[model samples]
Target: MKQLSLNDIQAAAARLRGKAVVTPLLSNIELNRRAEAEIYIKPENLQHIGAFKFRGAYNRLSQFSEQQRQAGAVAFSSGNHAQGVALAAKMLGMPATIVMPKDAPAVKVAGTKSLGAEIRFYDRWQESREEIAQDISEQTGKVVVPAYDDLDIMAGQGTCGLECVEQLQEMGMTAEVFLCPVGGGGLIAGLSTAVKALVPSVKVLGVEPDLFDDHLHSKKAGSRQKIEGTPESICDALLAPMPGKLTWSVNSRTVDEFLSVTDAEVEEAVRFAFRYLKLVVEPGGAVALAALLSG
Candidate 1:
């Protein structure tokens, strides 16, 4: 496995300059007072497809050889990554096929289809998305766009951290810590790497639903730890079974700690964001904020 570096993230940022949205770091006076700390929200919800998944998707899809792009791309995701790849392929003028859970949010499924991608639904509990994507790629001879385990995908995600640092620097301020929701560990893994490189003292914290703390358990075990039984949460996007191998390699070193929030706490955070910050955050996206509110 290759190690990701600042250079790799910098390269991805260059590629995404005109293509990806530079989401803003928004602040709310009430939120600061409530948390008793200045909390800056890097709203990747403003990104294409309403998530940071677009950053990695566009970065990887746009790098494919012309022949590969024309042949098309295949990916598997419960929601966000599906829409990311679907929308990116459309922007790059390529065909896209996504393997998604039958129980995925209606809005996300509709969003992917809205981008003109073919959808393949599967049983989320009984089936393997990776296996389905592999079969599709073999049948169609299209490249598989991995959700987060790919080198390019992680590097692409690192661009978000790079932007956060630059955005704070421009305001003549420095962050004491950075918090992000952890699913397969892609976003936090890549973002933590970049943030640590730029500001060594800034602690990077990864948050997940208490029932789905794969990263937390993995950190304690010193290896990848898969969730054993059925665990449930309203944060559907944070339910990845385990941290990706590629992402864990970086996260093990870059992240300072993992924090777990209950489903009720996450729900409350979502409500708080809408009421106080006027931001409609998805449950998974609100876990980090939930942790802050917990204390």
Candidate 2:
């Protein structure tokens, strides 16, 4: 298990300065009244490409060498990561090729294409995205940018946690519990590492759709576990078949627990975000809030 230190997160934060959005932690009076705790929401849905993934993608992409940048890069994602990589590459003036599922949200696909990346679609159930990405990399000599399996990506994602802590302190508060959605576990793994180091008592929990609870099961089993059947979740961004080996290494040590929410609960949470919070969160991005609300 590779361990990510606090230094790594700080370095990532430094690198992301003036690049990534310092997403505000929003506090609603009604939300706090209902939760019985001071509930603050980190609205990454407003992030570049409408998700937190841009943090890691830009972090990783910016570090590419001049040669690597010229060769271009390839990534595999259903939606969020695709847009992340595409936008990051565009910002860096590098060509990007993204392998995405054919059924991915049209909005996301259009978002990626709008960023000047070439799109290659594959069947979600019938084809392996990794294989397709690998083939593209081999043929074009483009480097494959993994969505969640690499340490740099995890460190970049850790910037979110670092920001959360800084923002909380500025507001004269400390988080007792930090909830975040988990798919391949990079987001939670990075967040857990940073939060635990900054505030040891803060509990960092990973939330996932009930049908795609590989992280939940893996945490309980004390090993990385892959789902047996097709992951049938409405949260397209949270449907990784299993947690990444590297992400699991960090998550297994830093994350305190895991939570699972149903699709119905997620839909209601999305509605809640829209109706009350005036935020538009996709199904996957709402899972953590769903878990927090159901509690």
The most accurate candidate by lDDT is: 1
Which lDDT values do the candidates have, in the order given? 0.92, 0.91
Alpha-carbon RMSD to native, per candidate: 0.9, 1.1
Write one digit per residue (lDDT tens) for candidate 1, span 151-173. 88988999999999999999998
Off by over 4 Å in 1: none
> What is the TM-score (0 to 1) of candidate 1?
0.98
The candidate that achieves the highest TM-score relative to the unseen native structure: 1
- Give per-model TM-scores: 0.98, 0.98
**Residue ranges of candidate 2 with Cα displaced over 4 Å:** none
lDDT of 2 by residue, 30-112 (tens): 77877888889999988888998999998899999999999888999988889999989999999999999999999999999
